[model samples]
Target: MEILKGIVLLLLVLVGFTMFSLKMPKGMKAMGALAGAATASFLVEAFHFYVGGDLFGITILRDLGAASGGMGGVAAATLVALALGSSPVYAVLIGCAVSGFGILPGFFAGYVLGFILPKMEEKIPDGIDLIAVIVIAAPLARLVAIGADPLVNATLINIGKIITQATAQSPTIMAIILGGVITVVATAPLSSMALTAMLGLTGLPMAIGALSVMGSSFMNAVFFHKIFKDKSTTIAVAVEPLTQADLISANPIPVYCTNFVGGAIAGLIVTHFGLINNAAGTATPIAGLMVMYGFNSPLKVTIAAALCAVAGLTIGFIGSLVFKNFKIKSVAEVRGTV
Candidate 1:
């Protein structure tokens, strides 16, 4: 109880600090608000896990996934809702639906939905910056996803099982790798994070870890590539939102080319390392990393992350070249003609 109170106080302080920061001319309001809320949410969920585990049946790991996913979902839902002139209730309902099964899904349910809802939002007269609305929704998104996960899980599992049975292989990759792919496969209509979380539940962290090791520089490459190769102001801001799809949408050839190189390198390193995703519901390397940072397999985990970076960078480099030869120029052209 004492620990819980301390945590609450800390979170409240962070929130208050963030609120105050928003008044500053140089302070980044969105990032500050998110940091504050995330700190609070993290503390709240952590306490729930530490103290309430026996009583509430919450695992610290899963709880992390739920909280983060819920936060992302709520934010995304609210953004989509505001952008599309829909009710927050409905947006949150769908956000929960996106959070199906595990933590990654919970987080991503909102992300993919943000993309999907923009078209609808564009239909409305008073639509706003989808990202801004998402910023508003960020804190509560994960909670919404957590609340809606049971229904989402049931439906996703049925679908995953059916797809697995129908197809020879399932697209079950870990949080980062799979998340990267989902980030690429913009039209697949799958929730990237949600799918990754479900896969995580099946105990594939080693594989994911391996890939992360293999593609450690994937995000880094994104950073470098944007700084070097990308020529657009609108698309260059990839790291801020952690979105490659938007880049692809803005300048498809460069992004597409980058994906192939990045993905291939990632696949090779992951397969070579024989590492798999840890069996957490949300397979973000960050999550497993936090849990086992100083644990028994720290070195191996680090290696796996390095490989993931390699995978993403190598694939991005090569894929970008390939994009130059592709039939379409802009992502809009690719989609519009299709």
Candidate 2:
């Protein structure tokens, strides 16, 4: 029951974000900024703090990681505000105001400021507008962040705990679900990194997310090669699915279904080895694998990673064959190069 509830809640969040990205104004830009913030903060923390600091005793790197992690909200607010078309000055101001908040709260604050600041700038004279922002916008941004913090903890954090507990109780089932879902998200605009960070996933669930996405690099590479037969497109997808997001989004069924299969297979392999990742938001390909070494044996992580690669390759090939006849939009078609 707990697992079911977690899955439902997770689905709702993903779907809601998807709808926002598709329907809301500047939503896709905001989400892209969020992904960048996650990479800047969470990925840095995973590599430096967990892998470098915990594993190799690098004090400077550890301190750097700690600082980066704590500044997630600031990064999110600034980047998101800029993405949403705020001036750089206003964006940084909003970010500073939301310094102590979580990423989601900062995102909310930035989003609100993005719209309001532009209107304020239009109505008020230049210097007076700056004063207005200092007195009103900055405080308002912090308040928005403060208001959002508790809700984020209540909903997203609790859902993460429920999902992690479900993994403890039924590793196999949770592995398949989380593996498939998170991998699919990697290819989507919502971004697996942002989702995992927001949910605060760690432990076996985090491991499943990390390695499964690592496996997907191979899967998407092979799948895109088979489908598009374009060297650039294939390479882009392998490096980062978001680079080819429009192409992937245009051909969702084959890409998403194939990723689900590959991710599920990788998840099973990870669960079999009882791998764990204590890093909360390292659900990325390279950093994901790197962080595993902090929590598990190096040899064991390497072995599991190799198996996942094989699984991804095998599924990618088989899926390519299965979907050979499916109609897909060519890179040329999507990019209007033809």
lDDT per model vs. reference: 0.40, 0.92
Task: Write the residue-wise lDDT of candidate 1 on 1-338 in tens digits.
Answer: 33333224323433543453356332333232222233333323323432334234567745664465345434444444433334565466555544423333443344434444545456545545445445544434555556656765665444343332322133332333333443333211122223333332232333433243224335435533533343342233322223333334455445534543454345444444444433333222343334323222557657756656655665555554555455434433434543
Judge candidate 1 at residue 191 and give its lDDT: 21
Total clashing residue pairs per candidate? 61, 0
Sliding window of 10 residues with minimal summed lDDT for model 1: 185-194
Error of 2 at 136 (Å): 0.8
Q: Estimated TM-score per prediction?
A: 0.45, 0.98
What tens-digit string does per-residue lDDT give for candidate 2 at 94-140?
99999989899999998888889889989999899999999999999
Q: Which is the leading candidate under TM-score?
A: 2
The true-versus-predicted C-alpha distance at residue 41 of model 2, in Å, is 0.8
